[model samples]
Target: MTEEKLQDDIGVAAATEASPEEKSLREKFGDQVLSVSAGLDCEVVVLARECIAEACHYLKNTLGFEQIMDLCGVDNSALPGWSDASPRFEVVYNLLSVSKNRRLRLKVGANERDLVDSVTEVWPTANWFEREAFDMYGIIFNHHPDLRRLLTDYGFEGYPLRKDFPLTGRVEMFFDEAQWRCVYRPNQLTERVLVERTWPGVDRG
Candidate 1:
């Protein structure tokens, strides 16, 4: 067979072969999984927020995804060509199965006020990851015991990772020599400019 034809056959086979994790999730959850797609390094599954906790439990207990590798929040609102129909924010979970030598990515969408079910019960490491997400993006993890700021001051006003957050921040902190304590004062910047971002390979002119 020619090289091009051989490549085509390999692509076809890969597209037709469903990963075991995907098959198991589909068999167990049915419609709770909104969609599944191939990501750069692993299969990405988008699940309904209502079923996230249950799905995480199933993945850990049944599918052998024993480790929660990492979890973070994404603010898609400011992305170029982002759709308004989709949720403004998303929580992404990276799971690993050491026994099977496999990895999986799970995503759940949430709006500004939506509360996502915490997976800290499934993986204790998720405690700090959830708190960091909350601190940076204001993504609330429901039932996360001791959900508090993990990276910022307790009195910090806005979510720094949000696209709409000011560049200079709402407040500035300084150490007072006499009091020997950090003092926060309102930002006093008189002028602010919003710079337009340019992406590589995109022609503006």
Candidate 2:
């Protein structure tokens, strides 16, 4: 099928019941983890600012998805993670149910200015992951006991993963006590300095 046709079909499918894998999940988990997108193994996504906490709780307690295998945050400001409403940051939760022997991936998108609910209450391992997400992607985990820089040094300015953040570098300042002077330099922006050369008889006085 043509690209346009395929896109139309996908839209229609989303309007109805998500694909088979997602249909099964809806039948199983009900409204716990909404299947916003579905294809091969079921791509379930939830809005972080809206239903992240509830979804994590259900997946852990009700669904017996005890183990949070991995948690990652992705910056989707450039390309929308989902539909038009997909936000600036996405918190992806990879869960494993040891008893049920199943694996699930839940994606939660948060607006640039909004924060996702913290899952540390359900999974202690989530603490570090959430902190990392906040540190790199700037996706805050609301209600986190402590939120601060992890990889970058304390008092770091911008979110490194953000697209708009400087890729070349940042400005740095230092004091030159030897010359009794202070120096400020923009690490990313530089200009060439030139000196004038004169002949032997040029302006000797």
Candidate 3:
């Protein structure tokens, strides 16, 4: 699609209600969609990870969710950690229903080594979005034509967005003019709290 075609989609209004679509989806894929929660301005559907691609297809083809607005990954390690705290990661997709003027949010849980089905075939723009998620969270996208890092180098070591990845990163890269190529070395930055904490109970008078 060209720029002019894209402009037409932007002018479409967002649908405030998804009751009809929700009913249709719930009836057809009750097992796949775990829950449906609607708010004042938005609706979210928690779906099973194994059937995300199929669910998205139904939404776009039948429910009139014509456009995929955005897709990104989330790291949930900080929220809570336990023996069976849900998956450590989640991939979120935002869809726009131009015809119905509705917006829907889809999310699927992903584990450390699991791969989610690539939605590129359904929405070509998902190509870059899925790559970005994989690059940042190491959440693989199975069957993506070109699944590569979007923001990081080809040989980047770890998923920078993971909560465990140090704020300073695992390695530091610098241009090595001596050898005429960039080089990475063990990160040298360290954490040190320079400010002293003052308790409210301490007498300052």
Candidate 4:
């Protein structure tokens, strides 16, 4: 095959598909399906971290769920007791079927160290989803092609969306004659500098 055709084939393979079985399974699972804010138009399913890869396999091969509309990760670090050792981060997958005009949602949860199994083998679009999740939430997607920062700079430290992250942020930049990049994560706020102090200390005495 030509280069262009090969590229197209790869792209098409990654695309998602919706099917009739999705609708049937959605009804069967009921509330466990985990539909989000979209009343009834959207479909969702929540699954255990260990089962996510398997779930995707089932939805795709058994139910004809060919299209993976979106794959995203959510950080629940704000919740007390959330830790790297326990399942906290959630990975969400959206599936669609063109032939049946139906949609489905799937989810999996994991802790900091836990690596969610890769679905890229099943849905090619999952390649980017897993990358984004790893980039933003620090969740690992095992067996991904390129599991690295997708949006953040190479030197970025921690996940910005985490509740503990400061609003001003701790981004570091070169501010000295040496021009060497250094860590700028400030621990205290008031220690930086006060605006009034720059006005040349008034001689009240």
TM-score versus the correct structure, for each prediction: 0.89, 0.66, 0.81, 0.64
Per-residue lDDT of model 1, residues 78-169, tens digit only: 87888989999999999999999999999999998899999989999999999999999999999999998988886788899999988888
Error of 4 at 146 (Å): 1.5
Candidate 3 local lDDT, residue 96: 96
In model 1, the runs with Cα more than 4 Å from the true position are 1-7, 177-180, 189-196, 200-205
**Per-residue CA lDDT of candidate 4, range 6-44, in tens?**
999887765434334445555545444443333255645
Candidate 2 per-residue C-alpha lDDT over 10-114 given as tens digits, one digit per residue, 9 for 90 to 100? 988766755443554466656655447542563555643577777678668877789998888887656523454656677888888888777678887677678
Among all windows of ten consecutive residues in candidate 2, which has the lowest summed lDDT? Answer: 39-48
Better of 3 and 4 by lDDT: 3
Which parts of model 4 are misplaced by more than 4 Å? 1-40, 79-86, 174-205
What C-alpha lDDT, on a 0 to 100 scale, does residue 55 get in candidate 2? 65
In model 3, the worst 10-residue window by lDDT is: 9-18
Query: What's the lDDT for candidate 4?
Result: 0.70
Clashing pairs in 2: none
- Tens digits of lDDT, candidate 3, 67-113: 99999999887753333458888899999998888899988998989
Indicate the residue-level lDDT of 7 in model 1. 100
